[model samples]
Target: MTENQILQVLDKYAKDYNFPVLDNYNFDLAQCRLSVFRDDNEWIIVFEIVGVNPSLYISNDIYAYGNSVESQGLIIGLDDIVSLPNEEDLFDDEGNFLITPFHLDLIINSEPLIIKPTEGEYLELGIQTELFNPTKLIRYLSSKYKEKFWLEPLDLLNEINMSEDFKLFYQTDEWEHTDEEKPSENKFFQSLAKAIVLNDKNLIQFKKANTHWSNWTWSDFEKQEED
Candidate 1:
């Protein structure tokens, strides 16, 4: 249906069923919002509710199925049929989730490094390990490499984006019924995976030099002064 027609349906629902209509929203890129819109074929109206958290959000959709113009009266005969999720089902009880795509895309060494949470599933419930935290990765690299690491940032990016295991980990994090055992959480695996990919001769050299210097005591400085 057209936007005007959608608005009219919303207005009718508000008047007849006392349904609240929230059309305009200014998202902060750190919060989630519910969406109600017609399907691509205009045969169904879909209502999507997003459960938000600090790192991400979880979403579930309900449909008012049938053609709007059909005798089915899907849009006209609107009812407040709602199914609420249990408190445990919510991704973020504090409600600090982000639904929009992050604006942290980078072009490092001519390769694109994007931070996209795989759909809405991998973003929450510990499926996303620390390696998936793009900001943290950036901060760590910037401080450790003096901004020189961006020349080869794709190593870390690929580690995050190219892993089939990472995707499967999320896809199977929650299962309704299964004979196999659930996957155990691997908190350090993400960091280890990234380190395996990003470690190079330069980083090794830097680490060695830093470690050597870090071992110097005040007596070592005094010895140097005497020498």
Candidate 2:
């Protein structure tokens, strides 16, 4: 939809429904008055509609020790909302909205990387023990070796034989260990996932990095193994 159309829909919703307050929401209606922000490099629509209250401020103009100011505000990120066309009557399905090829085309055109699982390699072993999915493992090693490449995780998993106990141990301890070690690459991917899911613009850096990694050479892939 056009930006104007999107704004109109939001305005209509504000008038029709009482805006519900979300807990721990960090949007600033004033700052987002009519603009979008990049949260991890992804583009996100943010704005102050009506209803919700903005955070409070305390100010004392010379005389009093402290005075408070109250204002009602709303901050909404694109991730927090969904858009749909308006339908007049349910029984009369004349202008009912339908998914269009354009939507699918857009997704296909964007072509985000797909995380794959290795064959024969247990899921527990790859993500748990290796702390990397197929794409992630390749990306990790590529950077270490200063090369560019892509591969399916399922294919890699199929090549390795992992014992049951080893798989179990990795599954139980990987997340806990990751929290303590805070691997930069894993953290970066996790943040990127959140940005994509939320449509947060802030994650653009990681997205670019991912795009660059998609074109690595075979020699680069070999270097990653050494790392």
Candidate 3:
């Protein structure tokens, strides 16, 4: 059918449905192309609009001509669309139907954080050795330190630049606080204490002390006391 012929068909439907034709275009999907007829296509067409703040409405269908049969289908408003028709035949479809546009009323806005387990392991050890409680460490660093430094897990790993020895310390329990070992003498324990007292979020400098150590030096103990 010609473009003019298609437009005539769409006009008839628009009048019957009391819908005004806004615009039309051709859509392509996969390897196929089809014509899209629209009546307010400029308006955002949201298919699921129940929970949406401002609902959207779509008023067109996609149509493609085949050798034996002409196929027509509604364009669903979602991420999974594969093809759209060309600009010409959009109004050539035989019928006019009103379809609810997909509505994604994304109300909550939040940034996503990607955490790696390997990086998390190192970070957990670094914080623990510094004498901060694990839970408190994650919370404080995530809120305070991370906010200021904008340090993500990968950023933390890159900053530390630990050697194989430090990596091994993280692998082993050299920094973990045990019942038998008091928090005062242990370097890891003291670091945790200092981190807690001073509220330090500098994971880069903190990971510098990743080593197999039985105790902290007098200076380290003094730092915690002053903090």
Candidate 4:
């Protein structure tokens, strides 16, 4: 949508629902806000959206973000969250929790609205061997983000242009990512694709018997002796 149009939607939502937003917004103030009401859905995921150019990956055809999050973005008072996470468990402590700011995104086009973390999101928070507070927090948000999208009957696509001018706060091309293609290449996708064609149908396979060390267990003389 045009910047103006996107702002209008965010403006509408800011009025329609109350989602947790950053108190530490470091960039120029958000051009606008996007929101989702507390719901029982488990879909507000955390993952990187931007990366080095071209190697860049995205879920929707596009995404929208603001300035660099290192100097920016993040958190809730926590106790006020409307969904399922217990308030007592969210208390901030000096240890066992890394209460840092967050970077976020608004997924337009696909679902009615999805507020995902572009940075500082730890998806494995609840499942890790150590139960991190970030995990609990993310899980809580994800669950709350689970409302079905408002795409079809709403015909949101025609109404929104997503704008050509928005910029990413950041993408972890230098960091990690979730499960998908290029197992080894998932982190820095370009590194692997540059080294070898990942999606190539003629991908080469290696067999130990074809290497010079393949003869380490025996020699011609040993074969002759066997004969």
Task: Write one digit per residue (lDDT tens) for candidate 3, span 1-227.
Answer: 32233333333334443221111112111111111112211101011100000111111122211111122122222321111222122112553222111211111112323332333553544433233321222232333222321222232222233111211111111223222333243444344333323334232123343222213222222233477
Which candidate ranks first by TM-score, i.e. highest? Answer: 1
Given candidate 3, what's the lDDT at residue 108?
14
* CA lDDT, every model vs. true structure: 0.25, 0.24, 0.24, 0.24
Residue 75 CA displacement from its true place in model 4, Å = 14
lDDT tens readout by residue for model 2, 85-178:
3421211255432322112111111232333334333332222223222233322323332211111223212212211121110100011112
- What's the lDDT for candidate 2? 0.24
TM-score of candidate 3 against the unseen true structure: 0.16
Task: Score candidate 2 by TM-score against the native.
Answer: 0.15
Report the candidate with higher TM-score, 1 versus 2: 1
**TM per model?**
0.19, 0.15, 0.16, 0.18
- Give the Å error, residue 103, model 3: 22
lDDT of 4: 0.24
Q: Count clashing residue pairs in model 4.
A: 8
Q: Against the true structure, whose lDDT is highest?
A: 1
Choose 1 or 2, whichever is better by lDDT: 1
Q: Taking the tens digit of each residue's C-alpha lDDT, what string does model 1 give over 1-227? A: 34344444434443453331111121001111211122233422222211111222211112122234332112221111111122222124665322233333444333444555343333432223332332222322232233332112223213223222211111111111111221112212222222223431122111111111112222321233367
